[model samples]
Target chain A: MALADARAICPDLATRPADLVREATTLAALRRWAGRYSPMVARDGPDGLMADITGVAHLFGGEAELRADLHARLARAGMAAQSAVAGTFGGAHALARHGGGIIPDGALADRLGPLPVAALRIDHDTAEALGRLGLRRIGDLIPRARAPLARRFGPGLVGRLDQALGYRPEPVAPEAEPPHFGVRLSLPDPVGLQSDVMAGLARLLERLCEKLGRHHAGARRLRLELDRVDHAGVQVEIGLAGAMRDPARIAALFEKGVEEVDAGFGIEAMRLVATVTEPLAPAQIGPARAAPQDGMDDLITRLGNRLGFETIQRLAPAESLIPERSFQVLAAAWSRAAPADRPGGPPRPVMIFPPEPVMAAPGHPPARFRWRRMALTTLRATGPERIAPEWWLDDPAWRSGLRDYWRIETREGPRLWLFHTPQAPAWSAQGVFA
Target chain B: MRCERAGSGALQLAPTRVHEAEGFGRHAFALFQSVCHDGPVVWVGPAHAPERLLLAGLPQGVGERLHIVRAGGVDLLWAVEEALRAAPVGLVVAELETALSLTAGRRLQLAAEAGGTTGLVLIRQGAGSNAAQTRWHCAPRPGAGADSTLHQWSLIKNKRGTLGDWTLHWDGTSAAFHLVAETGERRGPAPPPL
Candidate 1:
């Protein structure tokens, strides 16, 4: 049925709902597939994609060959696509919408001249106004006075018209690259022996370390991927205590991980990648002092490869004043920021447990307190360093009162630290000395 | 000594001066020494109540030289890198319940290589993708000895080497590794108690 007759017959006909998300996903998939033809691709709109194939066109033989390939691929993917090549995004959009064949770089205006003004993507109201002013096509409006056109229809109309003829430049930004160092080995034949895999890994690690050395960088995390002949793959990652570029050290770390890669039906390919990298500064070498053997690092890498990275951690001092909040356990892979000078005072406990209640006076040490089923008596007492809570932050316990901390040496030779709040009149064991 | 040799010439070789050497009392003891150590940091018990246990243990006089960093909100990869850069006295052991991204893991690998220090990461099983070197599954083993307060452990997987499946009997009081033979197979002598 004709659109006008159908609209006249039915005053309120509901339009079919458009699946926007599906269309967007399809467009993204198309963009990825389009990369096979050219790296420079941009989404023209909901249903279009613009690909720059200047030098890439010859790869498929010529522009005609490239267009035919695009049509065949889109047809196979069940999409109805129309493509045109021009010097600019605007020209391409216009030529694709109007001109059927590919137009040379400078001939966009001539080809687009006969197309309706709607091809400029102007608003329906503006197009209707142009139609009423006897401006039915782009050819009719191109010769009109610029001042009158801008004053009557707004500058956007002229801007869109100029953009269609390649007067404006548009830039397409690419995706960000992931931070990783990788090396690959393509085996001549699938190998199932563990020794072969290890040999391959050793070679890859050497290459990766060389890359790290050149970049003045070290990796904290490394991954080895084994692509098997059965279409499945195995991947292993090893984390380190610090950034390091030593091939032996890195290989040691992956020792356990390499064993985990199942050569299911034999492995055909291998890839080594460093997932985390940090800047490495030059080390100081003294003539008199011999370099120490790094056995602990090798052990850590082997353990980390098998057990995983999160299970390992190192305790670092935190800035918080609260006893439990004053220290933190960080992962081995992350580099620690340099420690700042602590405020002058007696030493803090090396190990701290969660707050445990104690029975003691505010100023005196507890005569006897129960902890983990053991009764402890204080032999020495010191400190009443009162710490006030930041009122600006919401804290339920801070509402009780300020805490006066005491560093006390216990009779068992273990130093016990406790704190008492004035408002609550109760004591709590905060931490212990190593 | 001369009389005994005369009585039996075949038996008595003058009872060879059996003098035992005394301890070295005058020599000063050296402070530094190197030792080969392996194993990981372990935390036993349920996730709701975690117990941070150091498996490799601390070296003697470590209290004087060791540095502990309490880094909250920092990712595991960066923590490992930091520990590697701080070598000799460097060792970073963490128990993380969270997962890290691929990029974070790569950064950690690079840092470990550069620092020439060991990075030990202990993550809860199944918390994230299995990307670690070995990927072990540890479970509590039944105690077997006079010390009723001991826990046994099993080495589920060793990715680096063929450490085949083996049971380790641990005494909580002593914290030692004792190899336990599999129940069905009796091919080897019993491991001596520590």
Candidate 2:
């Protein structure tokens, strides 16, 4: 059946589906793109974006030029957009939808007077209430006493009307800034030589490092992209030892990373960027002015790049009292320096592993302990530092018993190891000390 | 014994004249020189193993110039800022699972311009959005010749004017890159035809 015939047969019809997620995503992308024109862009609703272009309007030659630019860009992107410039967000919104381009900012009421009551964005019940009271137009309702009108229609109606006429304040919340570092390269005819690619990268790196150096900054994270001839592209990135701004150094780092690309067909464009950055302090010069040998940081960077940043580990203080849980292994790129040892603490072992069960009796140190197929005789033993389980938490192991830890000195040397008595009569080897 | 004890006490109470005779005290002069000179480099990396290995590999002369600053859960831009503030020739490299914000990226761009040093960032292949100048995707390849001594690498993106797909025959032991013949074929073995 034709839509006209179907509509004629059905008096009430609702055509819109409530798909909020898709609408929200589209709005977010729109808001992000709108940032090109104004840094202060906000999502007004599910389908609208508001840009604070007050002083920025002049940058595009005028308000008209800005509007035209926006329209053109939206058109290119295949979106239908309507815009209005007003002193207030409500007036602009109402005018954009009701007055189109005819109404100016100061004449919002005059321009909006003729529009239907529904343009005020009131609920259906409110509109019906207004209709029953014979108040069909905004101008018609303005002459009524404020107290009486508010009493009859509630404060929301008055507030909406006031906002539409620019009587109330409106604020625009800007979007959060994104993190990125980039350098663009325009090529002539899109060369495809590896040497040429590296040369371009070197130039870009120089430009990037110059910018970073000026700000006393370096990049911890870097990304490289190749816009290929097929309209597709490939990206490669690397993490840094620390933030750095030297083009030669950065380029050298990429020299190792660029070996992964399979330039299907050929790439026509390239770009380099640092996704993460950090501040770098000025370097101090020595009195003798002799450059030192391999710096600790440089060695770390080489090792980090080769072994993978995650595999590089460091010890950090843990809250646990258990020997196995006293220190944690953390990634170097992400962790700070290790915490200092506690004052007047017992000496710790060079290495520590999880607890190992041993055949032993309570209150007595094992004459011999077998670990990893090796047996060691205990020549001396220290008293057990009793540690009670935290009763607050329902731990199954805690129910086993309280532990009495002992530092046993073996015949070979002093090995910091732990032996715990789970029950009153049984003892087991628990861990090695580091 | 009393005379000897009195002489030792006098020596302890008296100011040392040897420092004046030597022009300046060695400790004080050393302290002054250190105060006047720039501090060491802070090595920041993703983790400890690679960081330690890299530190170990550095020339001994450069090793003394370093102070290691290990970071955790830090974004790339902040890392760059830390590098800029901490070291004169500060270098930061990070492995990230996501892309940096546009504002952060722009800030880094400005920071790089301000500092005369260098920043190198590493990311996983095809992980985040495109926002870099020169991006190169690297992968390990088979070695050439009977000895199997060299490994090959492919250059994916060289925004520094290094274009096209080229091969690098690398000597792992030497940790250096050497130009190799380009097969003109893709890096991996060709896929079977449909």
Interface C-alpha RMSD after superposing true interface residues, each candidate, one decimal: 13.2, 17.4
Model 2 Cα lDDT, one tens digit per residue, A115-202: 6776676889999999988888888766678888889889988888887777787777776655346888977776676777789899
Model 1: per-residue Cα lDDT over A63-147, one tens digit each: 8888998899889978787888777666677768875578776777787788889888789999999999889989898888888
Per-candidate clashes, comma-separated: 85, 163
Q: What's the residue-level lDDT of B115 in candidate 1?
A: 55
lDDT of 2 at A389: 70
| TM-score against native, each model | 0.53, 0.51
DockQ of 2: 0.02
Model 1: which docking level applies?
Answer: incorrect
Candidate 2 per-residue C-alpha lDDT over B1-194 given as tens digits, one digit per residue, 9 for 90 to 100: 01121243211111110000011111111111122224433334443222122222222223333344455455334555444432244333343434555565455545544543233344444443234444433332333342221222233443334434434443222213355665775488778999
The candidate that wins on lDDT is: 1
Q: Per-residue lDDT for A352 in model 1?
A: 50
**Per-model lDDT:** 0.58, 0.56
* Weakest ten-residue segment in model 2 chain A by summed lDDT: A289-298
